[model samples]
Target chain A: MTSGLFHVPLWIELVAAATGGIQGALFAAGIRDRRIDVLGVVAIGLTVALGGSLMRDVVLDQLPVVVSSEWYLLVAAAASLLGMALQSVLTRTEWLISLLDAAVMGIFGAIGASKAVAYGAGSLGAVLVGVVAAVGGGVLRDLMANRPISIIHVGTLNAAAAGIGASMLVLLLRIDVPVGIAGPISAVATALLRIAAVHLG
Target chain B: MTSGLFHVPLWIELVAAATGGIQGALFAAGIRDRRIDVLGVVAIGLTVALGGSLMRDVVLDQLPVVVSSEWYLLVAAAASLLGMALQSVLTRTEWLISLLDAAVMGIFGAIGASKAVAYGAGSLGAVLVGVVAAVGGGVLRDLMANRPISIIHVGTLNAAAAGIGASMLVLLLRIDVPVGIAGPISAVATALLRIAAVHLG
Candidate 1:
């Protein structure tokens, strides 16, 4: 019975994990100048998606969320595999990659901020954690790829968009809007912001 | 009198810290892309030197080493400038960058592993911590720069080198080797292994 109510968040989490994984795989295969097999691709992808959250939990003196939760692992892996399959079928388009990156950043930023608040971190700390968490997976991927981080030096509006989106989400929560709506709203805002930036560019 | 004994470690730490910083700056400059500016270069360098240590401390539930010590900041900053300066002079030799990277990796692995062990981690845990600490900073830089992590999925000897070097250091320490010699031995081992891998490559 409890599982019924829990499925919504569970589904979201799984999707989020998969999104992260797919991004990582693309980066490894494309940027790193190597062909990552299915296992390597999946491992890298899932690690990136969950790395930030897992790192955050460990830093906060909790068991890493992915390690402790079976659902997180299963969902993340499934989602990544799904993404890999989709990417295989879909036409390779630069615009699509950009859009997905932006969308993921938005959702992740909200996830980070909300998770921080859930853990009772102060606002400033929450923001820091949120930003890191949102971007953390990408950062790990870039590191593996032997390059500089994308958000920091890239002329793109990545971090700025994420911060703004996160702020709005946190502000809404302070006023008691339902948590469920906040995540998607913030994610959409981030996605739109990035997509618009690219369009305007 | 007591402060003098403590000062010894601090002095050694300064050299290690600076070495790390300079390595970071040079790594950034060596990328052959003129996209990053001075601020980005320095920032990337500094993060590589400090990021892993900070993450280690944060995860271990202790105040970060940078937060507690002023010298860490100073050494890292100075080394970053030195690295940039050195890169300007040394870019003629294409392979020196790799050598510098291996050197930094070894020292960091040793330093990180030793610190983790001191914090009451088991031998395996300490070795793992050390490898992470050594490479963590560079990983951060790569990510920020949107590059791949040098440790994972790159088929490089980075983590393995770190693991072996740190584990040896910890083992020597446990067997009552004087603490003074352990640090250099581990760092040297790490550096040599990295350099040897480059040669084999």
Candidate 2:
């Protein structure tokens, strides 16, 4: 669901949305004091799934791809409902959730930076936009849940990892690497860094 | 500033930005444990002054006026610095701050709703946009400070007042009232409601 200017595969966007939705639903369900209903959980999930892309497009001054694409909402809602239904089983698999979160962050970071680059922003600006897009959804989720912002909190590697990936993408593009190749490289590197931090730290 | 599709006087936009800047500076100064430097405080002030407009424009799929206009940043920075310099004096004048805050919220709400209406959004959609615009800055501030969201907190009249003002603006416009008249009436009503709630409650 990227802008028509870019040519990311539809499946990639759907996967990103689904993963974000599942992670967000799990997060909302974990909050005990909020007394959030089913609809609230789904809404939070949708926010997490699309908030980043929405922010990215907003910063780029383009129409929000999420609003125009019906697939995003439908997939996010289904994934969120699935997450809610299997909360007990899914809670036991923390590693999977972490992996999903890391992947979502990485994908969004790559997409955002790429968009900025395409728009002719300087490297630093592209990186900044990418990091914002990477962490925007989680920021919204934490704010809604009244929790400390995860990206700004002590010991969190989110923004750092996102920045590293975005910088790599910018560097690769500068060196004449094709975007299709550069984007995946950036995403994988970011996810690995986040995954390593979580398991090792 | 409203979108190019609509015309709001430049003075009104500047006043709103200045008031928001001052209020934000006062707020950031009140937070004792953050160890926020002068630059941090100014950044917070800018966020409060421009965040709502940025969000409003993003939702409307229009370029953010804050990003495009040099006047907004200049005025907001000057007002924020002025607020910081007058911290002690400003803190003592609680009623004045409250009045300014209410006015800022009202103006932003009216502007946001009018933009939505101008874009041909339905009445309920217009009201939603207005409420989001009115409370967005404060929400961002609270999130940054890691405080409970003020708009959603029990006993707060912010969203309720904004909704009433936005609804009123929509109704007035439907009756063929000029936007200039409708906007001010809505703003005044919202401000009065907020002021009354603070004083009487």
Candidate 3:
């Protein structure tokens, strides 16, 4: 099946969506404790999913992928809805959110870097954009939800994880790996690194 | 006279700084009402000054102007400090806050568009970046302070003001107005348009 043939890339993006959703849900839930509403939650969710890419595109002087790619919006929204629906499930699996958060942060960073390279920017520029894209969404999400951002917090290896993932993705893409495949690999690297750091740090 | 030699541009930027500070203060004050602390207010002030320019730079793959230029950070901090200090004095005059907000918003937007043009992007891209630069700061400020963003609010002329200012600024740039002179002229146009909009709209 054509779907089967594209399964790897598709699955990776979906996983990204799921992770992003969970992150958004956590943000919303945190704010809900302070009495923020449903609309605010959705905005935070959507922003966390697309904010970095939007910022990336704005910086690059390109048409915003957030506005241009319909899939981006759909997948992000679907993922957040899944998060909202599974709130009870997440509560029981406390460790899962952290794992997913790490993974999502990594993949988004990798994708941002890889895409920047594909667009013909320098490797260094790609790396910087990657990190920004990775962490940026979460930053916006937290801000909107009225929570302190995760990046600036002590003992959080967010930038470290994003840097490693983005660097790996850019290197892989530079060497000519199909980013569709290499992208997920970098995401995993990012997630695993974050997890390791989370435990170690 | 020292005042005469001080020139119009210096006075305008000072006015701009005071205006921007009040708006930043208002947003930070609102966030404080919701229980965020001192760091939250500082972050919001920075966001109001730098968010748009940073957004524009990151997308363009350049080091953000906020980081590269002393003026951006200095002005933002000064405005924020001014705002924090005068919050009580200005709070009673809500109309003053509204007017200052309108003026600062307009000026920033014009500055963004002009900067984008200087960066060698296309006209349309410049216009978009300009608008982003103008409003990006305030939107980020609101989000950081945990308040409602004006961009998504109904019947808000936020973007419209920036768009018009951007168009004018971009148009003037195309005619080759010196970059230094263009910034203040465009800022004035934006400020006037915003003031007009408040009365007319």
The best candidate by lDDT is 2
TM-score, each model?
0.57, 0.60, 0.55
Off by over 4 Å in 3: A1-18, A31-33, A88-90, B1-137, B143-201
Model 2 chain A weakest lDDT span, ten residues long = A1-10
Better of 1 and 2 by DockQ: 2
lDDT by residue for model 1 over B1-201, one digit each (tens)? 011111125666566677668778887877766587787878888987788777666655567777899989988898888888887786363466666677777766766666665655556556656766777777787777766555554535665677678888888878877656887898888888877866764
DockQ of predictions, in order shown: 0.12, 0.14, 0.08
Ranking by TM-score: 2, 1, 3
Candidate 1 segments whose C-alpha is farther than 4 A from its true place: A1-33, A36-53, A58-201, B1-8, B91-93, B152-155
Binned by DockQ into CAPRI classes (incorrect, acceptable, medium, high), candidate 2 is incorrect
Each prediction's whole-model lDDT (CA): 0.68, 0.78, 0.65
Could you say which candidate leads in TM-score?
Answer: 2
Per-residue lDDT for B32 in model 2? 79
Q: Give fnat, all candidates.
A: 0.19, 0.17, 0.09
Off by over 4 Å in 2: A1-51, A58-131, A144-146, A150-201, B1-5, B9-11, B33-43, B58-63, B66-93
Q: Give the range of the ten consecutive residues with the poorest summed lDDT in model 2 chain B.
A: B1-10
